[model samples]
Target: MRLSRYFLPVTKETPADAQIVSHKLMLRAGLVRQTAAGIYAWLPLGLRVLKKIEQIVREEQDKAGAVELLMPTIQSADLWRQSGRYDAYGPEMLRLVDRHEREMLYGPTNEEMITTIFRDATKSYRDLPRTLYHIQWKFRDEVRPRFGVMRGREFLMKDAYSFDLDEEGLKQSYEAMFVAYLRTFARLGLQAVPVRAPTGPIGGDLSHEFHILAETGESQLFYDAAIDDVTREELLAADASTIARLTRLYAMEAEEHEKVAECPVPAERLRSRRGIEVGHIFAFGTKYSASMGFSIQTADGGQVHPQMGSYGIGVSRLMGAIIEASHDDNGIVWPDSVAPFQVGLINMRADDAACSAAADNIYKQLETAGVETLYDDRDERGGAKFATMDVIGLPWQLVIGPKGLEKGVVELKRRASGEREELSLETALARLTAR
Candidate 1:
């Protein structure tokens, strides 16, 4: 992907309406454009980042034993009616009347429809523990949608539903998602703490929202600082002897917080911090299943309403949250795991024969070697090109200028660290290949 051939419409001026750093940078970078008050049309760059985040969410969900299947964004209101929340749901529910005068809606969540699926397919406890998920768009008519994707009216989300015959079975499904959230955030380079949170519209007795700490975050979180230090591998590798160890760790939302000395985390490890809710899991025993008759027959000839749980991760909002957690003054510093491109190759003087040739060769070599890179072969000044490259935040950057090309060297600068070193062409290639 050459800069000259790319559709990135970066601007130097920040929009006056953007109130936060993440929102401002996203607009300046032209990653997204406002389609309405709280809706956006994701530009090429934003869409790429969205896909990368979506893939990571999907992989980690699969690893946690959840299967994937897509559900439609638009759902019939009849489903919600059966759940007894169709008209009771607030204005956030975008209710509408179709051409046939049938009540319908853009689904804000999928609990009702999922129940219909379960009730039709499974008749016995044999399929007791089933978890299915989908990555799709959702709509909520936010009265005052603001903060870019953080509180958008329309967005992408990964929602998974779990159905189990008994409380014992439901616990297993909940634990799977609990651990999955940890791994998903860790893999994306986020230190997310799972705090007990309100289920809101998705009623439940047990719920936890995985919050990623960021200064510009919307949620007020109080957490055990130790949660940040624990890694996904540690939690996933824990044996049955201490399987619930991670859950026992202290963490909670402002609402569920208890100012008691019994909190297991040490005083030093307790920090009241602000964070964005990226993922949430809930165990709503029989809420959706009982409402819609999604029951399985027990061996004793009794009907049992399957307990249910729903897990959600804001797939699109995560892109903005990642930028918020990781960016500096320059621009978006994308984490390598979800970076749209791993490296950027800039021809400092695209018109110069030597610089152009070297950069072209390096770009081709990197691509041939299976490296995702952006070749900035544009008719722009060196400073402008460098600034743009820094803001785009590729992990590694290769700069070939006429001056450096004459010495058979190019400037290799890493984005994470503003460290630049002149390296011979062979050495630069080697470092990039090793990455």
Candidate 2:
């Protein structure tokens, strides 16, 4: 993508209303624009990052034996009514009356709808276990939506519902999603700790929320420091035993920690930190199924409600969470996996014939090598181009300047470590493509 043709509307001045680092950086970096309060228009650059995150979530879900299927944003109010939660859901749900005078709603969650769908499709015990997921936009009427996408009224979410015939089956499905969540966060370059959390509106005795540790998080957490010792490799290949070990480790929100009579974690082993919630899973058993009239026939010819679980990852909120966890003073330092573009190819002196030619050639080479490179071919100053590159936070910045071109070298800089080295054109190409 060429900056000259791109629609990035970056600004140097931070908006006065922007309160958090991720919110401010997202605006300054031209990742998103506020269309309404608590709602955003994801610009091209931001959309790329979002899609990358969504794909990773999708892949991890698929690996965990969950099948993918898209669900609609709008759901029938009758679905909630059947589940005995229409009025119970409260004002956060955007309830409305359609043109036909039928009660309707923008679904905040799909428990009721998914239960109805699964129930109508499966009648016998043959379809005992199934996990289906969808990535879709969800809306909640937040009274005070703030911190950009971190607490937005409208956001994208990956929600999966698991249906099982018995309690034991639900446990297996929950564990699969638990492992999937760990691997998903690890793949996104986040150190997310799974902490036992209240089921709240979801209504389940078993629930865990995956929170990514960040200084600016909304929740204070008390956890066993050993949770951090579980390596990324282990998380990627985590099994039921891994889940058991992690669950046994003491981890809780401040609210939950306050309720405990005595903490099991030794003071030395207890680590308190702030964390932002990114993913949550609930083993709600028959909450939705039973209430929504979803039941299958048993082998003994008895009707039984299917045990169910719901897993959710904040797909759009993850962008803000990642920025909160990863950004520095300059701007967002995006992880390679979720970076909009892997490399920023800047023509430091676009007006200079030599610089332009070299940058164009290098951009071609990078693209041909299957590297997602954003080429800054605009007739802009070197400093401005460099600033844009830094703010956007591409993993690598390849600067082709007149001076560097003359010396048969280009400046290659790594965004995370701020490491810069001069490499010959061929050498730089080889290094960038090798990965």
Candidate 3:
């Protein structure tokens, strides 16, 4: 992608209404634009990052034996009514009347709808343990939707629902998703701690919320410091015992953490930090199935409500969460795994013919080598080009300047670290491609 042909509308001045670093930088970096209060139109760059996060979530879900299927944004209000939550869910539910005067809503969650689907499809225990998920947009009608995408009223989400015939099957299914969430966040360059949390409207006795630590986060969390040492591979291969070991450690949100006297961990082992809730898992046994009359036949030919669990990850909110956890003074320092583009190819001397030619050739080489490169071929000053690249925060910046090109070298810089090295074009291409 060439910057001259791109639609990035970066700004020098930050929006006055923007409160947090992620909100301010997202505006300044031209990632998204506010179309309404608590709603946004994801610009090209922002959409790329959102899609990358979505794909990662999908891959992890697949690994955990969950099948993918999309559900509609709009759901029948009757679904909620059948589940006995039509009146219970408050103003956050975006309820509306359709053309026929039928009550409908933009779904805030899909527990009822998924339960209905499972009931209609499966009649016996043979179809017992099935996990289905979808990545889709949801509307909550937040009274005060601020902090950019972090608390947006309209946002993307990955919601998975698991159906099992028995408690043991439900436990196993929940553990799979629990481990998958750990791996998902780790791959996205986040250190998320799973803390015991309230189920709220989801109505589960067992629940955990995965929070990513950040200084500007909304939730105050208390957790054991040992959570920081867990690895992705270890979590992915974890069993019931492994999960129990981690869950036994002290971890809770501020509201629950306030009862410090009840906490098991000593003062030294307990760590407090502000964190953003990126993922949540619930093992709500028969909450929706029983309410919605979703029952399967047991081996003894008796009807039994299928146990269920729901797992959710805020797909769009993750962009803001990542920025909150990863950005520096300059701009977002995107991790390579989720960066919009792996390399930013800047023609520092865009007006110089030699520099332009070299940059063009290098860009082609990078593309041919399957590296996602953004070529800054705009007729702009070197400083401006560098600043723009930094603001976007690709993993690497390949600068082709007149002086460097004349010396048979190009400057390669790591965005995370302000480290630079002058190397031959061949060498630069090799390193970037290898990454």
**Candidates sorted by lDDT, descending order?**
2, 3, 1
Better of 1 and 2 by lDDT: 2
Separately for all candidates shown, the number of backbone clashes (residues 3 or more apart, or on different chains) is 0, 0, 0
Candidate 3 whole-model C-alpha lDDT, 0 to 1: 0.91
Compared with the true structure, all predictions reach lDDT values of 0.85, 0.93, 0.91
Whichever of 2 and 3 has more lDDT, that candidate is: 2
lDDT of 3 at 212: 91
Among these predictions, the greatest lDDT belongs to 2
lDDT for 33 in candidate 3 is 100
All candidates' TM-scores?
0.96, 0.98, 0.98
Model 3 misplaced regions, further than 4 Å: 232-242
Each prediction's RMSD to truth? 1.8, 1.0, 1.1
Quote model 1's TM-score.
Answer: 0.96
Model 2, 422: alpha-carbon shift in Å? 0.7
Which residue runs does candidate 1 get wrong by more than 4 Å?
Answer: 232-243, 258-268
